[model samples]
Target: MKKQTRAIASTLIFAMLLGVTACSKKNSNKSKKKFSVATQAETTEAPSETTESTTESTTETTTETTTEATSNPLGLKIDVPQENCEIQFLPEEERFKYDMVLELNEADHTVGGHVVVNFYNNSSEEWNQLCMRDYSSLFKEAHHDGFQEIEVKEGALTEVTNVMNETTSQALTCNRDADVSVLWIPLDQNLKPGEHMTLSYDFKATIPLVADRYGLSDGVYNVTNFYPILAVYEDGKGFSHEAYYNFGECFYSEISNYHVTLTLPEKMKLLSTGVENTPANADGKNTYTIEAPCVRDFVFCASENFKFFEDDYDGIHIRLVYDEAHPCGDTMDACAEASLQAAKDSFAAFNKAFGKYPYPEVDIVLAPIDAGGMEYPNLIICTVDAMYCLTNSYESFPYEQMAIVVAHELGHQWFMGIVGNNSGMEPWLDESFASYTEFVFYEYLGVEDEMELYSRETFDLTKEPWLTSMQANGILPINRSFYDFEDADSYILAAYSYGKIALYQMEEILGREAFHGILREYVHRNAFTNSTSSRFFGVLLECAGQDNADLNKLIEVLFDI
Candidate 1:
């Protein structure tokens, strides 16, 4: 979630943190597709009824009563489990499963999918109806994300039809929200707690021709958030409500397992969130089998004219899929090399600073995307075309704009991918942390002058041209929801620019060693679970010292939290 306006000069690097022990062995490999590096565990919760406000029931005014925890008398979202491990996965019986079979039509830019979602009622209340987010409908409108170049011409939705209960073999009916992306499917029977229900449905998605995350640009197809995903259910509230906002990410879901078999044109190269097995070609079609366990969401970016460049770091294979022929220039090779090195640096730094990345592969897609960059689970799409690619090495780099974007997206691997959060509500939890990792990138790489320049402007919010006003504007600055922001510029200022500065100031308050150590603990405790900005504050105060009210005062002064 990088701001598109990052063309700062990159000369100096701060050798602040101690150098990590990294041994690189270069090998010219084509993806070298590796699979099954992470353990399969954990499932996510369903949704409950809540308003469209930024303050949901989960993160509310708990000042009157402490949060339910032993160490966390504040009752924060993160509570140290009795048996904490590197991977705290939910039991298989409690985990949800999505078995999908899809066929991609390259000619039509449409995907015909048959999805079977096996849901387990883990909540205290019985589920009467199921909810999902139809993000594809957002693309059909006349407008799109402000920064993105859009062409929305009608074909963007597929009503969830042929929904049948796999357990009882009963046909189902659904209700669609005309205004928002929320879809409500009334259940025939009440799915009680400890009960397992299997429902299958048929859907067809039309990939609009746009330079956005979920669209068809040139020959490349960015298929993301395109499915009818189950909304997270709260305990007291009904299914959580999240409308599609063009400003920031509004996706919220539980960690689940995906077993998918996709049939597409053989010429298209695929890069997805999971470990993909080699495809079998038949009748000019490539049918690939992919599996991703304990992931929040599944996405893939496919194209017919993608060239491959690859390298391996820390046993994880890194693949660079670039389309340099159409719309993209020839400097893609240089961008790939720089982007791969940044990926390696990101893995090393986040491994030491937070925790080890729990995946076998990472894919970097350098296409002609509109915005800065977008991050999925294992794949990241960065738009580095013509005037974009700064031909330079990572060590003595002059302009490190590409590396900053790549590092920010990779930072989501830890914040958004590994540790989950409600992006619509508390975007600062993920976007700002991702932005803060940019500083960690320079700090780890010892980009002293570059770090100084970036940190200076980031700390001074008025310097950013997008932030039109220095006033608070009556809205909760960093703590507000996506719907709260009037425009994209204000959202970027709060989530991207100001949020990272707050964390950096936190590091300055507590020495770097303590700060990094606390983050490592935070990720381990909250891995595969959703976190809140308040919980982050509680963790900081819990680790540093609750006696110090400096953080409380800082939030009041800076972000008006």
Candidate 2:
């Protein structure tokens, strides 16, 4: 989910130690020269005139909509039509929605929550049980003392048990595998198809002091995946009970509407996934109500020392939250406007190439993060280190790194946020696409030369070497589960590096216009739902001409399918 650059020789030596020799003999005949820097025609040429005309038309429509929606172009709010905001990609009957009330205790860094979910049985088969992912328990299992207490308040369940709760006194009847992030609640009766059921949960958790998706670092509190969320269910496959993988995303869910209320200290400013309504202050605390429509997940960040800045792009509100004491605080403040504009341009280019971004606002926050950046539905967290490097007036610092990170995360607003994927199984669906989108963003800005330089340094120079080394060592294919890799580094090489290479090879085979057309169709079809590697390959085969033997060979080489 984040971009990382490591040395080449070290990676190869590590891969050899793992006994990855499956592809060694096959790769022996291949020359490294085949992975040379992209040619001028491939990297710097402007898009075709048709693509330019399409961009202009889309920009015009966006401008008209922006003008009609707001008198002040820089306002912090934009009104989007209800129907346009719906998750139209999924069937109307299958949508699941959530109503939650969460109280954050700033003094103790704890959260207590109550959530009511209206889950529709969209599958033809009847349901005998429901499963929810307890992501916070992963922290507990890692020796962090955070507690994830879940009690079923309302549902058709005969009994509820936290199969992973080691401290609970409940009778242990369920299996406890090495992966223990699921809560199994059995239903008293089989829920018929086309019927709906309401399930409510009361939960509590402590915020760990760590640099992760859900934790408190310094004075900022980041809360993500802190609640028990319903797992996506298949008729015959049941729920995807993938264990939490620390290296990559292991969670998957359907798009759902969220109405959340958070009670926190009055002084704390909150930036969350949804639109915040007017806050009510009472007894030294403020209760904020946020409403998010058709989103896969909800996250929030709170800081009493946070400063806020806002801008607008085509009626979409852009806000940045940062602490002045942060290492990149001054840099973030100085570049906030430029960063937001870059994001807008990125969105425009993505919309022109893929599909329209179906949200009215996006919030970018500079925070302490474990990665270069992380993306939610309408929010992105840029790491303080990246921001600092971007702003540092040093010759050694890579100034373009910050822009690439921002663009990559914003790319996820479409890739992972809207067009969903099981990141644990097919991380390339988001990571590789987002990485490729960074190049697209650069191309859209008429900075193809810069993109080429970046690509050479990142992919061609650094990642290609490691990938070649891995290929020579016969490493695992890119399409495996997240935890199947030896470590995070291997996953990054497989998912991000080789994944982007595969996409680029495909683009080279199919012209740019045709490649983008396929991507646009993919977005149009998969928005608000999950996509698999097979479906992606099917789309590629459809657009790239299935009879193309070279393309088929490339796919086989990359995915080993």
Best by lDDT: 1
Off by over 4 Å in 2: 2-92, 141-178, 386-399, 450-470, 473-476
Candidate 2 lands at a TM-score of: 0.76
TM-score, candidate number 1:
0.81
Model 2 superposed RMSD (Cα) = 11.9
- CA RMSD (A), model 1: 10.5
Residue 511 alpha-carbon offset, candidate 1, angstroms? 1.0
Q: CA lDDT, every prediction?
A: 0.68, 0.63
Q: Can you give the TM-score per candidate against the true fold?
A: 0.81, 0.76
Tell me the tens digit of each residue's lDDT in model 1 across 1-561: 644433211211121121111111111121121111111110121222211121122222211222122353323233432211233344456568999998888767888689999988878999988988878877766665543444576456665789888888888887888755788888888899879999899988777887767778778888998888899887898777776655468788888888999988888899887777779999989999987767889899898788888766654567888885754355556657767777777776676687656666778888776667888888898866445344333222312445667888999988998888999888888988998897776566554343443343454333333233434442236767777776666667667766776687667666565677668767766777888777776667777776545555555555643
CA-only RMSD, every prediction: 10.5, 11.9
lDDT of 1 at 341: 70
Q: Which stretches of candidate 1 lie over 4 Å from their true place?
A: 2-90, 144-150, 389-399, 449-470, 473-476, 558-561
